[model samples]
Target: MKLLLLTAGSRGDVEPFAALARRAAASGHEVRLALPDRSGVDTTGIDARSLEADFSALIESQGVSPLAAMRSLRDVVRPVMRAVIVNAAQAALEFRPDVIAWHPKVLSAPLIADALGIPHVLVELVPVMTATREFPAAGTVTRSVGPLNRLTYRAAAGAGAMFRREVDEAAEVMGAPRSRRSSAPAATLLPISPAILPRPADWPESAVLTGAWRAREATTDAAAPTPDPALDAFLAAGPFAYAGFGSMAAGDPAARGRALVAAARARGIRLLVATGLGGIAVPDDARGDDVFVTRSVDHGVVLPRAVAAVHHGGIGTVQAATAAGTVSIVVPFIADQPFWGAMLHRRGLAPAPIPRRRVTADRLAEALAAAPAFQTAVEAAAARMADEDGAAEALGVLERLAGRPRNDALRHP
Candidate 1:
């Protein structure tokens, strides 16, 4: 099968597709991935291409009010997102994939697939699309609003509708009229562990809650040198707290780093701080032997050895911490982050969420002191996720779709 995978956003949004691509390729299927041009994504063994826009540049700093964030997303992010979707549509035409799987950000995929009469799957990092009474949409409210929970999904629908004109333009360029773009995706795959958040009964059967996708590390030649000796040494020294805010422009990273360092010092624990996408910065005065700062680290490699993981509550980081069986200390900044943090806390997997605005050295130290209490719940959740292979399950869906009669007319003559 020739599969085309498309996604847009930060590393968190792109990595899952990359993992799925690696798995599909390993299973002897041809795969192509289209995503934003960004560092920190592992595209080693898969065929990949860059979309036109660099979506990372549009990421707003944390602490913006919800209304302000929505306005900025409309004025700043939407244009870039539209461009990316168009680029993905063009890639689909060129690749003529037998099956398509795309992040929700790429609204053009469904139109393209409908026009070509091929199967397309929607890949959600969170439960934004499917309406459920169990909880409100991820970024809307941290708590459920009873029977009104189902109505919150209109926000996601409106978000996609905002790009309707652009999506139609892109599809029209590929000989797909607006009328032919009505078919729904073959499946909606949420690469989240059911253990952390059980599937709601209201979801359609087409929606599958596959566990978090973890990409395999590329095999390096024997002569290859170690990537980061300092990080390796830090892990070897003793158990430490892992702190990183991947791709979130946490406001005033330097100050945030200082607070984290102070908190670690207060608790008398070692700290491994990763300044991912400038979400956290290590101040000059705070650098010490007990504190190791790096641009990035493999969560799979480092988190398992750590005593706890501290992050901005991105679903990717949440799942990583869960899979590693490391208790979390979520310092949510914006959007769905707080929701994930609250969910973890409610499940007894972590201390109560500490919003970034409320984060202080004393508060962080308290959370760190309390982290050990959640270890049992964290380990039990990890055990539930241990046997899951989300990437493989997603690939199976694509394979089954590819077995159907293909639209040979859309292929090259």
Candidate 2:
């Protein structure tokens, strides 16, 4: 089978899909991942289609704060997102994939798949993509309130409305039916561990909650020696903690690094912080015996060795921490981060969810202090997740959908 994956957003958003692409390829399926150009995605062995766009520059302009960016979303991202969708349509026409698995942020995926006469699976990394009375939207930290809870589902997909006309126009150009009521994906795949979030009873039968995704293999950086030797030595030194924000560009990465150093110093815990795309700034003198700073390390290699993991509550990071059975100190920056943080707290994996606004040095110190309490929950969740293979489950969903009637949006689970 030939699989085309349309992915957008940050590293955390793209990594799991890339992992799945790798898995699919290993199983004798040809896979191609279409992502925006210069996004710093690693695709050494996989077939990747690069879309033309300065996605990095766009993100830099918007800042890493999800809430701050959301304030001007329609004004800032609408045009770029539209352009990307057009690019996606072109890619669809060129690749002509048998099945398209797409990120929720790829608003034009359904249209592309519909035009190509294939099945499109809505792959959600987080549960907030669909709304239920179970809880408020992932972007929020509130409980349900009547009809508003359902509106969150609309809110997450609301951006689709902004591009609906263009998508329809593209579908027309591609000779697809224009009367289609909605461009919703053919089926939904929630690639999260049931250990972290069990499937909700109210979710449509078309939606399925596979286990959390953890690639059995590892990818290394050719540019630099990775899982960096220095980091390994630091972990061997003693019980240390790791702090990183993945793709969330911090307000001041270097300053954030300094604060992390200070907080760890105060709490009397050794710390190793990963500076992703310069998420943190480390002075020449800062990389010393006790408090270490490095560019990036594989969570699979580092998290388990550490006592805890401090990071933005990205689904990828959450799953990594859970799989490592490492305690989490989630400092959410925006979007579904708060929801992940809350879930960690409610599940007893963390003491609390620290919003970026409240992530001062003292607060981080206290969060670190409470790390040990998360051990029991962390171990249990990891054990449960270890038994699941989300990539395999996702592949099964795609394979089954591929054999069924192509245009039936409501025919799946």
Cα-based lDDT for every prediction: 0.83, 0.76
Model 1 TM-score? 0.92
What's model 1's overall lDDT?
Answer: 0.83
> Model 2 misses residue 357 by how many Å?
1.6
Q: What is the lDDT, from 0 to 100, of the residue 68 in candidate 2?
A: 58
Error of model 2, residue 168, in angstroms: 4.7
- Local error of candidate 1 at residue 210 (angstroms): 1.2
Residue range with the least summed lDDT across 10 consecutive positions in model 1: 217-226
Candidate 1, superposed: residue stretches over 4 Å from native: 60-76, 178-181, 216-226, 403-413
lDDT of 2: 0.76
Which lDDT tens digits does candidate 1 get at residues 1-413?
Answer: 99999898888888788888888888899999998876368787779988876766666442335565577776776678778878888898889999999888887887788777787888988988888999999999999899999999889878777777778778777788763435567788999998888999989988999888766553212223337876667778887898999877746888889999999999999999998778799888998999999888877778888888999999988998888889999998877898899999998999999988787899999999999999998999999988888888887777888846544443310
lDDT of 2 by residue, 105-222 (tens): 6766776776676778888887767767777777765455666677776676565676676666666656676646544677788888888887776888888888765465752222
- Poorest stretch of ten by lDDT in candidate 2: 218-227
TM-score leader: 1
